[model samples]
Target: MRNDIQIDKRSIGINFIDGKASVRIWSPDSKSLEVKLENKSIPLTKDDFGFWTITTTNIQPGDLYKLVINNEQEFPDPASVSQPEGVHGRSAAVDVSSFNWTDQSWNNLPLADYILYELHTGTFTPEGTFEAMVSKLDYLKELGVNAIEIMPVAQFPGSRNWGYDGVFPFAVQDSYGGPEGLKKLVDACHAKGIAVVLDVVYNHMGPEGNYLGAFGPYFTSKYNTPWGNAINFDDAHCDGVRSYFIENVLMWFRDFHIDALRMDAVHAIKDFSPVHILREIKLHVNELSQHTGRQHHLIVELDLNDTRFINPLEEQGFGMDGQWIDEFHHALRVTATGESTGYYSDFSGIADLAKSYKDAYVFDGQYSHHRQKFFGIKAEKNPGQQFVVFSQNHDQVGNRMLGERTSELVSYEMQKLLAGAVLASPYLPMLFMGEEYSEPNRFMYFVSHTDKELAEAVRKGRKEEFAAFHAEGEAPDPVSEETFNNSKLQWNLVKEGQHKTMFNFYQQLIQLRKEQPALKHLNRQHLKVSFDEAAKTLLLHRWHEDQHVVCLMNFSQQEQKIQAPTEASNWRKLLASHEPQWLGKTEAPETFEAGEEILLQPESIVIYQNS
Candidate 1:
């Protein structure tokens, strides 16, 4: 009954106590349940809480076992913390308390001060292991990134996956060095003064190795998700289902020492309970944070522009810290590349980008051509840190026909322009892995499913999806090992010519964002954005206290001439992408005169501080 691991306080998973192991399984629908371990079968007793339990002195850590339902149907533990072999293998007992952690003095940074760098464990490095990433902590720190949002590490079908296909939510991927490897990475990151954000999927389970239905009604038939049946959060016997995922959230924060959880596609999580599941998670996370005396945050990936998610709980909302704003990326991409195929059709260029700067949502209450309906609610009341902005992310790149990154879609100057726009905004900025140096490799969607039929179907689905973009030629095989190899980041490019320059440009921009008074504080109320449609110029003016900063951006391929933003012009140039040091083709004066016509180089950005 003692809370050894704060998450294990529920007493659902197998726990070791006083030289004995206690096993518990929640199978409300099962008439009988027993443990099948080694060569023996141990029967379990059912309780009023609908969980079958047993205690045996013979069990030990590292032992693999499965639950036998009604003495016939056998499946891995639903609350397994270690799936050693794979998702289909038996669950192994893991003693998380055995690891000695030295992060006692470490705590997470405030959400407003975060500069996030998102990376996939498999593709971020060649070794593709959590332990392998320890070597790059200093590199990220040097790049001015204080937090890293890692893609999912749950136990999936095979060694190669996007992690959304994970079946065991509690277990870390065996190919990624498992739980111990993850702990070491977190500990090292904390030592380097970097926070860790983990991506989690609760919408639906993967097709293969998913056996939750055999135990109980973990899913509901009333509503559906993009994957299939939705989680049973509001249906019959939903308390157990809610507890299952809430405990998972606590497990990551308490056991792994993760600072935040990036919930994947929260719009897909169909829940209609009296109190939403997200609110429950927020309540529990707040409790855990209070108990541990560490700051923890919940960030959601929501398609809708609803501000209710980030609104405080007392205001009858979910109270999430932030959500990813895809509209900003869409507008910036359309402006940079002139690509308006699928969803990009909804956004108009610099205007939306400017709107996203002042207001968090560009499509707020506007009719979306792609959806053929009025979408989004205005979120201007929310603070800047309530939204996260990026020019390139996993969905923006991998969902493409060729998986081409933003760097591949536009010229070098345009890439710099996009980075400047994202960093200058009132919201928090994020950079996809390999984006700082503009790595040439692609981030295609690749998978390795054990089921041959399912694998083939995935390839077909990918091809059909590409039809929306009207891409020519066949897509590279997603199931091919070669595809996974092609997606890995080219780390060597960092030391190369133009790539190295791009890295410095990003580093300077981030450093200015943190050090400058106007840019450091994420205050939406003290910013103004306006765009000239004819000249393809956007002006962003931000101020905090008395420090004023002006960003002049030219999005056109041709050079633009714009009037000065202020009549009194004694501005200090903080950064100019057209400078020779930034590998630019043109140069401009360091200070601007009053009523002067400033010439902006094609596809370049210039930041000036009012002197």
Candidate 2:
């Protein structure tokens, strides 16, 4: 019957056309389906494609409705745009063309210029709403971040979540000011010349509050994910499921005016099909971007260390714009802290940092002690701009036993040094929320599942996961309200003593990176990195055309002398982390000559510009 039907690919959801409503839902399992609205049941005719359709003037914008399957079971529409009363409640019909948008001149920024700041909508501000985030746009703009990567905001179980448990793919989170509030936030961000990148999960849906399985076979037990069952991408009757998610992505770009999307944990997306779902998503987004005349970019979060995600489509690869590179973070963390445990065991010395700086990935086709196998392919030819590097992110911090940040593990001087390395690297850099001022709050994992058994299981499972850390006392309960409350950033600390000084240091680094041609070049060919094993020091040489800069960093506890190149030349002191103005006790040096010995303070970094 499906083979004999001719279904419009674009007519899979509720649509408003010329003062009339057309409703469409695909549910092969349901023997009968009806649209329930205004305490009235309107029968829908089933098509050969297993999709029920109804054309009527009864449904209007702002109408709350549900789909009744098998003439007995009622569930919220899976394609709902707004779930005002939680995920399990009735869905509200929305007319996306009604919103007033002022970002007509805005375009997606290039990957080379991205200075991403990742934040969670619920924990970013005290108010924990999109309206609250709008007030902080000026603050983020002043922080010199050109892009804000908001964690997933799709509708989840209840009022509070990290958003990865979202079940309604199309519905905006009700607690975070809903759909209208999100549009306002996007409009404000574009007005400030700041791009917004939203995190989206496609590998699996949440266990609770999902009615998708009741409608059709949207998931497969054939494969397993760490979270749950994987989405049915290559399984039987998977076409409608694929279209559902692909259209969801299109809705974000075309309807919400989102500039880019960051796909979460793409390595978990298992597709044995000849054409992967990732490629389909890329092609569809590309087509939508051309028709809408808007620049839309796709970024994937993968630890596979595969360069094919960033490769062009014509090269038999998924055409993604960029990807998150964890090797850079691991190398930098091990080099600074000298902690070799868990995944950090694979990297131990400062040479690892140099390797990452040179090739973008340090574990390229190498034996990994942590993984106990040869891991990752070589990506030496990829542009550094395509790799998004960060010293701290939600996963790096929250996945730990105590949810402690790098600032908590290292000294003040090391924090400055780490910031310098990340900001100065040729790769695009991202900062976790509240990382600028070293906000002391912990970003612990928290959720509010309505199911009692599921909540207790999450708490018990988290304790077992961190048993190897040997952390003091017990782990925090992830389903507790206190855990979520404690994770909100302490915004008042930014103006206090050392916090203000550290914030100022980040501002200077960002300003210099943007103003200097050599820093913005972001080309690995123009960058050279070398480190001293015995001295515990690293040096980077970056140049573009005639402008050049040399960075000297000392990770040792004692002061060490580093050398400049042998070529006779004059250099001026541009910036130094040890300067008294940056809350360091050392006095500032004026200049240095080629072949000169420069003394670096303990755990400090200094930058010199060729004059």
State every prediction's TM-score relative to the real structure: 0.98, 0.96
TM-score of 2: 0.96
Q: Write the per-residue lDDT of candidate 2 for residues 1-611, one digit (tens) a residue.
A: 12221222235567776787878898977899988887798888888767889888999999998999998999998988889988889999877556799988988788789999999999999999999999999888898999999999989998889999999888899899888999999999999999999999998888789889999999899899897788999899888888788878888887788888999999999788887888888888777767877888899999888888788899888888889988899889988888776788789668988998898878889998888999888886778788899889999999887788877899988999989989999989999999899888999999999999999888888888776655567778888889999999999998999899999999999998998888888889998888898888999989898889888999889999888864339888778999889989997477888988888899999988888
Q: CA lDDT, every prediction?
A: 0.89, 0.86
Q: Model 1: per-residue lDDT, tens digit, 1-611?
A: 11222543545678777778888788988889998889888899998878888898867899899989997988999889889878888999876555789999998999999999999999999999998899999999999999999999989988999999888888899999998999999999999999999999988898889989989999988996777899898999888888888888888898899999999999888888778899989988888888889989999999988888889999999999999999999988888877889889888888888888888799889899899999999886788988999999998999887899988889899899999999988888999999999898999998889899999999999899988888899888888899999999999899899999999999999999999989999888888888898888998989998788989999998989987767346787899998899898777788987667899999999999888
Could you tell me how far off, in angstroms, the CA of residue 568 lies in candidate 1 after the best superposition?
5.1
RMSD in angstroms, all models? 1.9, 2.3
Best TM-score goes to which candidate? 1
Candidate 2: list runs displaced more than 4 Å.
Answer: 1-11, 566-568
